[model samples]
Target chain A: MHLSPMPSAIVATELSKTYDVKVRDPGIKGALAALARPRYRQVRAVDNVSFSIERGDAVAFLGPNGAGKTTTLKMLTGLLFPTAGKAQVAGYDPWSGGNPFRQRIAFVLGNKQQLLWDLPPEETFRLNRAIYGVSLADYTTRRAELVELLLLGDLIDKPVRQLSLGERMKCELAAALLHQPEVLFLDEPTLGLDLEAQQTIRTFLGEYRRRHGATILLTSHYMADVTALASRVLIINRGRLLYDGELSELVARIAPIKRIELVLSETVSRARLEEYGTVAHYAPPRATLEVPRETATAASTRLLTDLDVADLSIQDPPIEEVIRIAFGETEQDAEEDTVRTDVQRAPP
Target chain B: MTRFTRAMIVLRAFWQLNWLEELQYRGNFVASLLGTIFWLVMAMLTVSLFFRHTPQLGGWGYWDVVVLLGIFNALAGVVETVLRPGIGHLPTDVRSGALDLVLVRPVDAQFYVSFRRLDVWRLADVMLGLAVSGYAFVQTGRAISAWELLAFAVTFAVAIAVVYAIWVTLMSLAFWFVAVENMAALFDAVFEAARYPVSAYPGALRFLFVYLIPIAWTTTIPASALTGRLNPALATWAAAVGVAALGASRVLWRVALKRYTSAGG
Candidate 1:
């Protein structure tokens, strides 16, 4: 028997980051008070989050806004120091600012830019070439390949301010990869892109990963990004890791029910649909039901035979629902019940 | 072949990029040149205004002070060309968390941050300043000696280093006081004092420049070398101060890096 090789790229253990953010009220009195005596509050941006990435693996970090996904990426890339626990990228401590570690990792942020705004993108490329100490020969070859791959021929000569958002993002990706870093941390890489531009970037990233075998940790609010690019997903909420495994496993664990849609030839009573399973939606000649994954096939067969069904299909629940459940939205009633039970049991 | 050579290559790349970027804004070139000329003329008038009151300042004639002013302008040009565009952005970078990109690169962060950007039009100020210094030297009827020329070259390099160290020291404070958006303004306010000879200042300001703030090393020492007024015995002291300034700045940079929690953190 033959086995595939494992690529070990990033290892992190219990990483955390706490920030002392200065807080002051809004008023002249507050301003004078702050000047006389400053006040600070400590907030935990990343609370003991831990995960690992295998080399050549693409992992999606899924979280809602302010869920510490960006903070964790910052820590892994050595942009921020962890208050507790250790993180190592390509076998070097990221926070050390050692040359070897920096050479091995790349970080790209959608909101922030490294390109020289007034200069052409090509100039920035040359600057990166010299700064990263790439040999002239290698620089020429890699640049040609990137320009071709990213389709950045005419865009490269235009000043960055003149380029469209999609063009700038393409050039940004080229700039980040100029040194061929083994580990890549991308935060919201697809944010604010149209459908076609998003698909273009997604395809480019997939191909880049396949060719380079780079370890990639991506964070995005768009579910399509994860479904298309990542096989494994890590879910975090409120600065804590909730789940980490294959994407399929996460769906199975959080939303065990599969959605079945039936296009009936005739209208069906809402009561009849309720007997089959949970009626998520009901309309003319159409009805949707959520059934247990194990019972999905049986339910679909029964619906087809019992009703004059024209068409029918089954799909796993959407990732957004899975994330909402992960964030404790579904457990609200249960939590309220527990609180009520505790209150009744309490002694006076 | 060496790290310094590699750094020079990086600097050259930045210079080319900066030059092309500046060329697009040709109008700024005119504005910058006008600003330099206006300031140069103002400096000369200030010298004349002072000469009206006294025959000499700190035992140096009018032309000698003019030469020092020229050196001051040249150093100011260096600041605008390199330091302002480079380190002047540091506080904002720290606030916005953009400095994270600077830290992750394979290059030395300090070196890259200090020389990564240049404002090309300001190089004109450097040329005009040297020309003014030359004219002042001629007006003083000072014959050029090989020794004096060599001394000027070395001390002028020292002046640049001293200026760079001051910038590094000031900008590094962004790590601790991340909200201070105008750190460069603080430098500008203080550096304005260096436009005049240190000895011409009141006793308290002289002490402040010599010991406390160390702006004396920026222009006065270099001008002394050019005007044949440098005490041969003091050359060693000037060299030592340059070395010490660089060393202290390096240590401060390390400390500041330690203090950086990054933007979000």
Candidate 2:
């Protein structure tokens, strides 16, 4: 057997960015004092981190708010220079302003719009065609296909500001794809959209990846986007890459037990449920049970044979719960470390 | 394609898009034309009041001063048409993090940013200003020669170049002082001085406008070229000043961009 070199779309090694943030206290005097001799502080927006992503691979960047997710994305896109590290995308340094590298990628920032605010989406589409030097025939074909897939008919002709958020997002996604970029840096593509729009965008992205084989790195708060589009996820917290693995592997690592909910015809005692496994919750007519992942089937069988049950269903714990638990454990450890450091600085 | 050729393609696309978008607001063209005419009348009234007293303040006749005012309006049209809608949006773009979209483009950041959009309706002021200048030239009753025409074109380009450099210098400061979202107001305030000849001011004030702010080059030199008052020696100095202003602004832009850590997510 022969092994091939990794065909990665992105490679980052110990990439980091720190900011010199001006700290201001609340008051007129503080502002005046700031004008005189401003107090400055250092914020480690992204600490040392390293990761590589393969070509045509979709990865979800996950983190809590202000967890350096946006900062890391900005660094990778060459919007900000890293304090220490090297990053390469598509075999070129992104920060070097290499037009060839830039022409091969696209970024769709949800909070910041790229579409001409006063112009129709079609005009923007045409403008991008000229900038990216897309052939007329290719642009027309892609525009038609995207319009049909995204269900945009007359919507593309209307001014962008006239459209609703969901409609504008549909156009936004289409505009980013007009150039047919090889790598897409999508920051919350489905943000602030309705459930139906989110579902539509997710479906479109999944189908688009199939058609074009473009690598997508998306940061979205909606789990539906992550679970539907990306097979792998990167978890960052406090300027660190805490976990990088398959989505299923992450769930398995965090939760090794399956949640078994038992609806009883008659009242079930806690002691009776304890015979099976840990009883997460118990009530008069209902009992929430937890069983080991491997023995869920066997335990369900024994429970059905042993108890008078109205309904029994087994389910894995929700991904949201798993992540919350994971972040909680790490946050608590970080809190403890902070407390220790605070004590050391107290006397000095 | 060469980088310069590609930049031209992007610029052509921008103009077409601007035309299409402005077509939706057809009423604004008439409204803008009326507004420019109204301001022109007001400016003429102010000039007449000044001429009512002095035969020539700072050695310029009534029509000579009118030529400067026309040049001022034309320079203002250039500001409103191109620089305001384009580079004037820089501070807001920086604050809102919209510049991230620009930086990722295959185009040159500075060139694309400076000419991204045009206010088509405001271009009427440019034509109206030149018409006013031509109307004032007839009142000067001086024989206009081909040499003066060529000199007018050169000085007009220098005027535009200087105004562009001033706008770049002011707008780039937004990167350093992020709170200066209304920094363009400083330019408008200082540009009021260019409505008259620089010599109209006191010696110290004229020196400030000439060397420090360089607003004098924006209107005085162009108007003097058309009036045939620009000496051959001063024309050479005006050209040098235009180049120097442009070079200084470019240096300021590069320095200020280093402080841009871009706001918002």
Q: Model 2: chain B TM-score vs. truth?
A: 0.97
Instruction: List ranges where model 2 is wrong by over 4 Å.
Output: A1-7, A256-324, A327-331, A334-348
Q: List TM-score per model, in order.
A: 0.85, 0.88
Encode model 2's per-residue lDDT on B7-97: one tens digit a residue.
8889999999889888988899999899999999899899899989989968899999888888888889999999999999888888888
Q: Please write out the lDDT profile of model 1 over residues A1-348, one tens digit for every residue.
A: 644375368888998876665556799989888778767656567778878888889999988777789999888888777889998788788888477788788899988889989878888888888878888898888888888888888899888999888888889999999898899999998888788778878888898899889889999887779888999998886577888888877666666788898888987899989988999889968888989889999998888888899999997565556666555556575377445433432211
lDDT of 2 at A199: 89
Q: Cα miss at B18, model 1 (Å)? A: 1.1
Best DockQ goes to which candidate? 2
For model 2 chain B, the run of ten residues with the poorest summed lDDT:
B256-265
Measured against the native two-chain assembly using Cα atoms, what DockQ does each of the candidate structures obtain, in the order listed?
Answer: 0.59, 0.63
Interface RMSD of each: 1.3, 1.2
- What 10-residue stretch in candidate 1 chain A is worst by lDDT? A339-348
* Chain B only: TM-score of model 1: 0.96
Pairs that collide, model 1: A7-A55
TM-score of chain A of 1: 0.75
lDDT tens readout by residue for model 1, B12-49: 98888877877789999999999999999988998899
